[model samples]
Target chain A: MGSVDRKDILAPQPTAVSESVSPALEIVGLSHSYGSRTALSDVSFTVSPGDFTVLLGLNGAGKSTLYALITRLYAHRSGTIRVFGAAIDRDPATALARMGIVFQQPTLDLDLSVEQNLRYHAALHGLPRAVTEARIVEELARVEMSDRRRDKTRQLSGGQRRRVEIARALMHRPRLLLLDEPTVGLDVAGRQFLLQHVRKLCRDQGLAVLWATHLIDEVGDDARVIVLHKGKILADGSVPEINAAQGTPSIRAAFDRLVQHGEPSQ
Target chain B: MTSETVEIGSVPATGPIRLTAAHYLRCLEGVVRREWLRFLSQRGRFFSALVRPLVWLGIFAAGFRFTLGVSIIPPYETYVPYEVYVVPGLAAMVQMFNAMQSALSMVWDREMGSMRVLLTSPLPRWYLLTAKLLASVVVSVLQVYAFLAIALFWDVEAPWWGYLTVLPALILAGMMLGACGLLLSSTIRQLENFAGVMNFVIFPMFFASSALYPLWRVKESNLWLWYICELNPFTHAVELIRFALYGEVSWSAALVVVGFLIVFMVLAVIGYDPARGLVARRGGSE
Candidate 1:
């Protein structure tokens, strides 16, 4: 990680032509259901550039469903998802090209070497060979995994694999990054490292981030938080705003109060 | 803010980005390359695919040669050796097996989350699926040719030019079988269910076709069984290759095989549609 200067690594590349001013991600009237069960209903939110918004929800709180809708893995007929002003339904290619994702489960080909895995992603994005090679080096160096580039993915530790995934996600220089419970099984130190790195990306690169997790401690004091329960949002605002609204001193207390009562803190 | 606006080297600050034909071609090439690399790494798979057909050609064909005589068929000018007659069938069998093997990998990919990564790409889902099918077809073609070469060494030789004619027939047959495999994969929700596919799909398709004996021979023994053999798509595929291997053409067989390929490929595309497929039913969460 120390090998590359932060400024150089964070510099924006021209991957898309965005003349319109729009939120990095905007979801409106997003609803989905499986048979008789509703997973999400009339959910709406906006993540602006440079904002690190945490989607806080426990298991089956519809966090994964929302991610699925945004990513177009499961299409929702009732809602509209826009990335950088492009509607996912009407102009999915453009919207998807401007976004990056780290799914909840590990997606690496364990039999492939680290560099081969990254190269495959680069090719999928249609990056020119010269640019792909340069970005691969730069991103690998940022994750401090340059030395492990030739090693097969199965040879690396779980923390190292996560770092490689993060590096690969940045290959296309996406303006918006969506990570679904990325730190799920990591140890304390690994989780801290990943959180710090992503936070820096939001601050330095002006990249909008939607980090979904159930853990309340991951939310910083200045970060925006959306608390989702059973298929709807209980509250949405900065940490302090949520705290004051619930008459609690911490986000954890507010979360417990809201989820237990199935409403806002009083 | 101005510092943030500094343009990186060479990349334009703003321009409308449109995906071109070259981009689609690159994606196709990448997919094919990945499949090739995986095939190279798994040496056992290559050998196992070859062994199945070779065993039939070596032992089964030899044992049947003395008992079951092959008379003059459309493609054959005179009495042909049973081993020579079964060459095309066995080669097509290699393709059928390889296509299902490719489907098995898709099931595994779905379980491991790699399928999610591929589906999330900005490219159209149909294009991605077609590229995957083509990759599997290429691998099947390679295995078919390898078996042909071994059969040649064992004196089950076709005409010198017949080998050249069989290339396109093999490709078409491979695509048809591979598309069927893709359809099965999209419907199958679990890896454990794949064994059922082998029993219900692979065995029935293979045994019901003319892979083992001539249609006329079956009609002499059982008229109902002969009609089922005549209707099997694998039967047309085998006949297409058989005629090609004899430096001739079977227009009806060619048409049926091509027709089946189109139908199976269409069904595969529909089976993988996000709204109607198993992926949609599961919501892709698990």
Candidate 2:
């Protein structure tokens, strides 16, 4: 992370995201549990096209649980989750087809080269063999990882690997991108680079993003946030709205007040 | 809105949405290719998978030759050495170990591996799981062939044509064992304790079946153990492979193997299903 080259970690290059005509993700009353322990309860939210929505939460705050439900890794029994108007369980093929996800854990096969990993993803999406190579080249170039395409994932540094993962997530041309704690282990520059790249996706390409993170600083001034604490949403609104509700100067202050006092900010 | 994104979010169909056959085919190829590539890179497994069986052939066969006395079994035309009697069992052993290895890897993938990438695919869950099963089966079949070729050098011979004919039997056996592994994997909550459970399952299945000894001999000793051997699916799998390797078909064993494949596969699918599966009951992919 310390030796990360600036050239290798390029700033977000503007690219056209596939346009989304409606809200990308809609969850209503989604709740999940593990035996006696509830992970999420009656969670509801929406991310419109081109919006960078932050799912803010602390550890065990149900952010990952929310992600698991949306991604269909775990079933949500109590609520309806619609992605681009398709319910997750009823029409999973359509619901998941338009979505791209970067899980909190590193999912790349370290033994495979960067290109192989990207190619695997394209194949999973059933992307045409002809366009797969071209798409891989395009996405790799966005992360400044074109030169490292032939290198095995284990050979790359942590930041470089994260860049490749982000590239892989977008290979399907998904309109909705969900990244769960994408900046967990990266350096300051790496984190900033990831933030800028994803934010730019929302700005330049009309891509809807749900960025889940515990880091308060990741919530920017223009960000729409859904603050989740202890399996419940404490605030679901723009940064200013949350701050105003809590009579605070910033979202950080608002979140602190909400978590400490156990009061809803909205 | 771009055509690509809008096309996916179209009004939901009432029934299972159909995708092009080519799409499923390509996904299958990609997954199989990845699984094979990963299996080969871990060189230690070659030693563990092949050598253990070879040791059984080289050592156990020598010691058991006169005492255990393999009489003319249906698969063999005349009296034979323990090595020849054990080849099919060892080949099935390779497949069984391969199956367990698949289960172990799936456990790892569940928590922090490429499984996240896999489950996220728009393809149906059953299709994805079946493709993964096929991948492991392909690897296990190749391992059986490799072991057979080596067995030839050791003078533990089967008819050359048996080499070609045994493939289908090995595949059926592989799937049965693989699905069983998948079912076991779905039940396992964590990775660290899997090997212990695997040893418990594998050793019991191997010893309590016809893999290393004839069920009749066990019948001679204890009728109840023979009944248990007859009931073990691994017995059916190994017997199916044994008869096939001798260019014969054991329809009963084959049917039993197929039956177990279906049962295990259904249980595994149920175990992995997000809506009603064990995964959601336990803590999900953490």
- Candidate 2 per-residue lDDT over residues B21-114, each given as its tens digit: 7778888988898888887788788778889889988888878877888778797888877888888898998999999999998998886746
Write candidate 1's Cα lDDT for B70-153 as tens digits. 989879888989998899999999999999999999988988778877787777778889999999999999999899999986
* Superposition error at B3 for model 1 (Å): 27
Which tens-of-lDDT digit does each residue in A138-220 have in candidate 1? Answer: 99998889999999999998889999999988887887899999998999999999999999888777778999999989998
The DockQ figures for the candidates are: 0.39, 0.39
TM-scores of chain B alone in all candidate structures, in the order given? 0.93, 0.92
Residue pairs with backbone overlap in model 2: none
| lDDT (Cα, tens digit) per residue for candidate 2, span A20-126 | 33356888898888888888889887776677889999988989889988999888889989887778989888777778999898999998999889888877777
Model 1 chain A worst lDDT window (10 residues): A1-10
Model 1 chain B scores worst on lDDT over the 10 consecutive residues at B5-14
What do the candidate models score in CA lDDT, each in turn?
0.83, 0.84
For model 2, the superposed segments whose C-alpha errors exceed 4 Å read A1-20, A263-266, B1-18
Q: What is the TM-score of chain B in candidate 2?
A: 0.92
